[model samples]
Target: MRGQEMEHVLEAEGLGKRYGARWALRDCALRLPTGRIAALVGPNGSGKTTLLHLAVGLLRPDAGAVRVFGETPYENTTALADIGFVAQNTPVYRDFTADELVRMGGKVNRRWDATLARTRLAQAGIPPHTPAGKLSGGQRAQVALALALAKRPRLLLLDEPVASLDPLARREFLQSLMGSVAESGTTVLLSSHILADLERSCDFLVVLQAGQVHLTGAVEDIVAAHQQLVGPRHHGEPIDGVATVVRARHTDRQSTLVVRTDGPVTDPAWTVHELSLEDLILAYLAGSDTQSNHEAWGVAA
Candidate 1:
């Protein structure tokens, strides 16, 4: 696992979890490649945490299986050792100090890197003696990062690690995390609502909507091929030459669309424009809504 090219440090197949009348995640299949940073983006209640919990084995799926390094992770200490997860909010023992947490990692984890933890803390300007409860949200986030890194896990899973930090702190934390990934070649899966941050730091992305994957691909490929099209009034002409229409808006005199393309543009009346990451994500989210509405109205003609 250490030397070989692991196709996926983590993988899921037909994964799902149900809570009576509702699903937190449904048939969620994921394949996270090694040595890359992936951001999981979704709206609130969109099963981001559910998918992560299943991936880390905090929660078991009812319908399918999750594999971390080709083995089930639920109670397998060996499998767990290769994975480090920081929950959506920062996790700290209120009475403990940063140094104490590092010591605990040394005691409990087989691959602890105490020196790295201390060095990271020093570099982040986090005081070793400060109690967990006394640190600000941002400093606490740094401590959490240090603790997770100290384990020296091959894969790091972060759930909204910077959700509570200030803007400046969030930027600093992401920069530090990016640096760690660059230095260690560690695979990272961080979930966030901030598309801008994800666009900057993640090489890959998973977009979730209504408990399912709306899209998954390399960030560059997704952005490079999708186009926004605006055209003069066309009453009923269908757009061609794109794999999918992610968004379309009409205002009587003109029509605009966001389409996923893989070939040269051919339509004469439409203006094709490259889409930003934000445009791509918003289009996907909007697509989910349109699909649901179509289903409700039985309008697929």
Candidate 2:
């Protein structure tokens, strides 16, 4: 609407999805800039999968809209072709060999990179002749990654790609993902239920709760903006425009709060403590009272 529109690979506004009477995702807005691995973290039923599905055009939104690579991907074959998606459980043809999967991928995507796919699997020691169903979970996951990466997609979407992996396998998958991303500079939206894995690999952060985006920003900025302030209960906390309380616990004598603050804390009675990425995420997930806080613990409606 103004100067050049932001260079976002994925942009969604007022995005919503529903199933019968239940809203799977409601009034969501997100902008994923180029080349950032934005972690889409939420609990098991927190609409993470729903949002990913909407993005890849697997499921149409019931309200609002989503665009990929500057075009809505739903039924847009050309748009989907420029994107790579690794679904949950890393599903590949159970009956197809690793090599066959590669060949199939080459035919499906207009821009094929058979060498890249084969070379990646070959380097990972995945036997091309073996059927994918016979491979170990980690090996299968690697083959899935290889397939997605070989698409040379500008944007890659991964939905809980490591949920079923052991610790070692998860680490290996994430490492492979990061290395390939660094090499290709592909913008990625990786959804997960675990914070530790996302923290290690993702620079951008998004927190979703009950089908709404509770918070989104740079990981460091988010961690830096939130703090736990402990002070006298009678003094009252500074919760206004600059300080919005995300969570608070008050005793007769003292009040402890985790707040997203943008200004200096001048109250001498309060002791400020920094929040870890995990702590910050948990606070928002557990926060309450929609009408009370205006500055924090919220995203655009």
Candidate 3:
């Protein structure tokens, strides 16, 4: 277990994918450690789904490579068995009852644990006889998660799993997920546009913008390394100790800059404010040229 915890759950090296004339993802790379709930954040069409699909072997990269548990995911039975994926829609057979789905999972996955599946569903208040089509959205999501968890996978990949549910339902679903993570020690890679949800559940963060990895690190470390500075407008004058200006906005008299820095902001000319995870992510996304600032921010491609 200690050796497993030390291994990387996912790694991408020079990964790229294209569709027709557009490159969905390009020169992307990141390493996610095992036993972490890593949040993948990006705007729509920023290649979040593409990256997730590639990681699960649902889509192949046009260039470079992606590995799951140090092995290529494509057509590798061992690698495939180690991963459990819940897509954006939380798809389940509409005609099948909750009990039927559990049975199907047992048949399909080599490591399926039927007892765990039934226990999770019971805890979520899902009746075994209820048809998936007749169940509430939250119930269906719970059923899907139960199926995934039943597989006893080493890595779990969730793509916007709660995007369609109501706030209370979302909270419940995440609670259930966290409970499973605690019990199973599964590494999780979850993608979502909801920053608040990510803040509550995730310890690691990966920010992808325009097919490139803009930032990747521990959530607390990234927040600690960035600051928001408000000061008098000083166009064309560089601020000392500022590693990179992620975003800059100006009013008539003051300039507000979101910056990445190596140390404390001792410059009295600027009032420094600590950033939240949402604030830091938005700053990177708001940059006009995120690729240009990667080196300065110490972000890998």
Highest-scoring model, lDDT = 3
- Per-residue lDDT of candidate 1, residues 1-301 (tens digit): 3545277888888888898879889988888888889999998889999988887888878878888888888878888888888887889897899999889889988898899999999999988888999999999999999988888888899999999988899999999999997999999999999888888899988999989988887889888889998898655555677777777888888988888886867889899888889879988887765466688888892
What are the lDDT scores of the predictions, listed in order?
A: 0.87, 0.87, 0.90
TM-score of 3: 0.93
Candidate 3 Cα RMSD (Å)? 5.5
Each prediction's total of clashing residue pairs, residues at least 3 apart in sequence or on different chains, is: 0, 0, 0
Q: Show the lowest summed lDDT stretch of 10 residues, model 2.
A: 234-243
Estimate, for each residue in 1-301, the C-alpha lDDT of model 2 and write its tens digit: 5224447888889999999999989999998888898999887788999999888889898999999877888888888987899999999999999999999998888888999999989888999999999999999999999999988998999999999999998998899889989998999999998888888899898888889988988898888888888877844434543368888788998888888888877667778898888878877877744554444657542
How far in Å is the alpha carbon of 234 misplaced in model 3? 2.9
Cand. 1 Cα-lDDT: 0.87
Candidate 3 residue 57 Cα shift, in angstroms, is 0.8
| Residue pairs with backbone overlap in model 3 | none
Weakest 10 consecutive residues of candidate 3 by summed lDDT = 1-10
Candidate 1 accuracy as TM-score: 0.93
Candidate 2, residue 176: CA error in Å? 0.8
Local accuracy of candidate 3 as per-residue lDDT tens digits, 159-179: 989889999999999999998
